[model samples]
Target: MDRKIMSLGKSSLVVSLPKEWMQLNDVKKGETVSFNIQRDRSLVIYPSSIKKSEEKEIIINVTSNEEEILITQKILGAFLNGYTGIILTSDNIFTVPQTKAIRNMAGRLYMRVMEADAKKVYLQSLTDESKASLEQAIKRMHLISRSMCEGAFTALKNNDVALAKSTFSLDDDVDHFAFFIVRILRNAAQNPYLANELHIDPLDCMDHQMLVSRMEHASDYAADITRHIIMLSGANQTIPGEVIELMITAGTQVADLYVKSVEAFFSKDVDAAVGIMKCRNKLEKLDIEMTSKAFIGPQKEAELVCGICSIRDNIKRISHCTFSIAEIAVNRAFKII
Candidate 1:
């Protein structure tokens, strides 16, 4: 990948473009290609302006015997893979159920049906990938996920069954944002121009992807804690007051740690990330104590213990996920400095 820099004149320096790249991009001697100086001080050459997005077409063959869910997944996969246009075709007329399913799937995505008939359906992306940004998507996920975590603790504190049940609904919203972020990262990995437009390299996209995945998992765990609370409430059994207070305290603290870790990542603050890491031991010890007390408590029904254990495991998992984010933040901080 290294090339020798040749002096053009008294001050100017130049490097030869690869012959293969020149041929592939149809570059002539007098033609211009764009060059960008990346955040890491690396230079990137593009055949055209990064603002000009590329379009991709994908054709999916649907079989009558194929299940609707499988077909839907294929359609979603193509969309997520950055295909700007998709055509779903079958040899025979699509069944009513199949047609309905396809429409539902397309509706859920950032696409619109261009044309639909008995044997084929055409869908085109409504999203302008160039206008979308990974940073904004990640921030949105952080806000929604933080709300989910907070909602779980609030439900537990008030023994509010309705609020606990609502956590699952919030988790669904988190899933949608996570899915969008993942799609953006996947697309960015393949399209350097798009990555540059987003102010990130592929490696940075990957790191942020890992952070998004962990946050999604943490959100799921928050919902799990709420689910267990709902179940316990339904059975007229309640967690001990001391244990409830402990769980709330631990969950809130872990949520704060997650917030700080994310802030460190965005700000490239190594000390803040390290500070979050320092709280890990205390969270782990508290997790152990919660488990032991839940197991040997005075009114330990199998069902109650099961719920307690699930909540304990998930709360612990949230803390671990928070620490993982801090770890990523620390790595990014070092790179930035």
Candidate 2:
């Protein structure tokens, strides 16, 4: 992998390319190559033809009565592998459950059923990932998920089943962005040409993914909070007034902290992350207070106490996740300028 630098004239230097690399790229004498200077001052030299990589296409065979979950996983795998087009052919007609699973997964993955019949299904990815903006996508993703978290707390305070359902439905929207961003990151990490187009180095893919996962986790905990709200509402039960007040106060603070953590992450503001992290003790104190008060209501109503505790625990989890995001923000900042 080492190439010796040789003096070419009075003030120039040159290093020859590896023969194996040139042969693989079909580069011959008189051919041109492209050189890109990375953020770390490393040089990325490649043949001109490598500016664009060929898109992948795949076909998966579905066995008779194939597990619906397996089919969905395969479809997701194909999409993550950078396949622009996926064709699924079943040995026989797809069962109703199989078809339903495929349709649902398509919605989640941003793929559409372009062509479908009794035994064949064709899916096309919706967007050119290279052209998509990673920052904007991640921002939108965090924004939606943040709203989900906040709404979960709102639904809990109000004990509104309809509101909880609406908030729960937004998790799908979050996944849409999560899946799209992940697909883009995975593809860019593998294809340097695509990485160039995305304006992100390969290392960025791993960092962004970690942050995205925490965002997703925060939203998932929030969704759990809403589920507890919905169950309590359906059961005609509610939290103690004291517990409600404390839980809402704690949840709101956590949600606000989550928002600031994401902002710090995108801005790479280490000071802001440090400031946000300082608020963790407040969450711990609130958790302790919530635990004592959550058990004070309805001695015979064990369900009510359990549900209130569940909601409180979920809020605590959200705060923990938010703090982790702040920590990640501080780390991610150092990787940049």
Candidate 3:
């Protein structure tokens, strides 16, 4: 693993490549190699031929008894597994509903429906995983999810039904970015070339996956709060102003936690991660106060109380996600040091 630096001349220094690595890569004399500088200040040397490989392909055979939802699920799985080309075929013929489902599912993902017929349907991934940034997408995902929480609280405070309904649309944006990150991570796990291109190791991919999943879940919770808002929109009961302020305050704090934790994650700031933990204690204390106020509603205001309780719970879940991010950030920072 160690190579001595040798002087080629007064101006140049060189180190010999590892024999075992050269043999594994089928290196030959006069062949060129590409060297990439990593974020950790490490150099990676690889054969130029290994830069790109054939695209992965998958096929799904639809059966007569197979449900449309199950077929759509399988397509999603294949997409996450890094299959760029997907074929859906049926022994007899695709039903109208089945064809519709495949089309809809492909539309949902970053893939496009290339071709479709009674017996066969083709899907192609439009996203270039190599070009899609895993880290940047996750960072954006955190921002969007945090904003969803903030928007939900704002809508509740202003009694803006339209704004609450708009939050649900942002959920789709979260899914789009999350799906792209998941696909890239999955590909990076299976392909070393991709890992090199993405400048992330397999271990780092696993850590990122946890964050991506949490962000997805956080987005879902934000959307759930929006649903609760819509439900509470028509209710005549008035929520106490103090309780609403407390909810908004707690939600804003957790949103800030998300931003800080994610910043620590990429920057490897141990102190920032630790700060998130310190803030968590305060969030928990506020939760107790929010819970007691949640149960103080009368029968007429029970539905509104339920909405308030769900919003509080969603904010708590968002805070929990930030806690996980902070922990991961601490671990990653320690490893880096």
TM-score of each: 0.86, 0.91, 0.85
Which residue pairs clash within candidate 3?
Answer: none
Q: Once superposed on the true structure, which residue ranges of model 1 sit more than 4 Å away at CA?
A: 1-20, 28-32, 40-42, 49-51, 91-101, 297-302
By lDDT, who's the top model here?
2
lDDT of 3 by residue, 105-205 (tens): 88778688788778998999867777867777887888888788788878877877899999878998998788778888988887677787888887888
What does candidate 1's lDDT look like per residue over 119-214, in tens digits? 999999778766887788889988988988888889988999898888767887787777777878888888767777788777788799899999
- Estimate the overall C-alpha local distance difference test score of candidate 1: 0.84
Residue 178 accuracy (lDDT) in model 1: 79
Give residue 167's error in model 3 in angstroms.
1.3
What order do candidates take by TM-score, descending?
2, 1, 3
lDDT of each: 0.84, 0.86, 0.84
lDDT ranking, best first: 2, 1, 3
* Clashes per model (N, Cα, C within 3 A): 0, 0, 0
Return whichever of 2 and 3 wins on lDDT: 2
Candidate 3, overall lDDT?
0.84
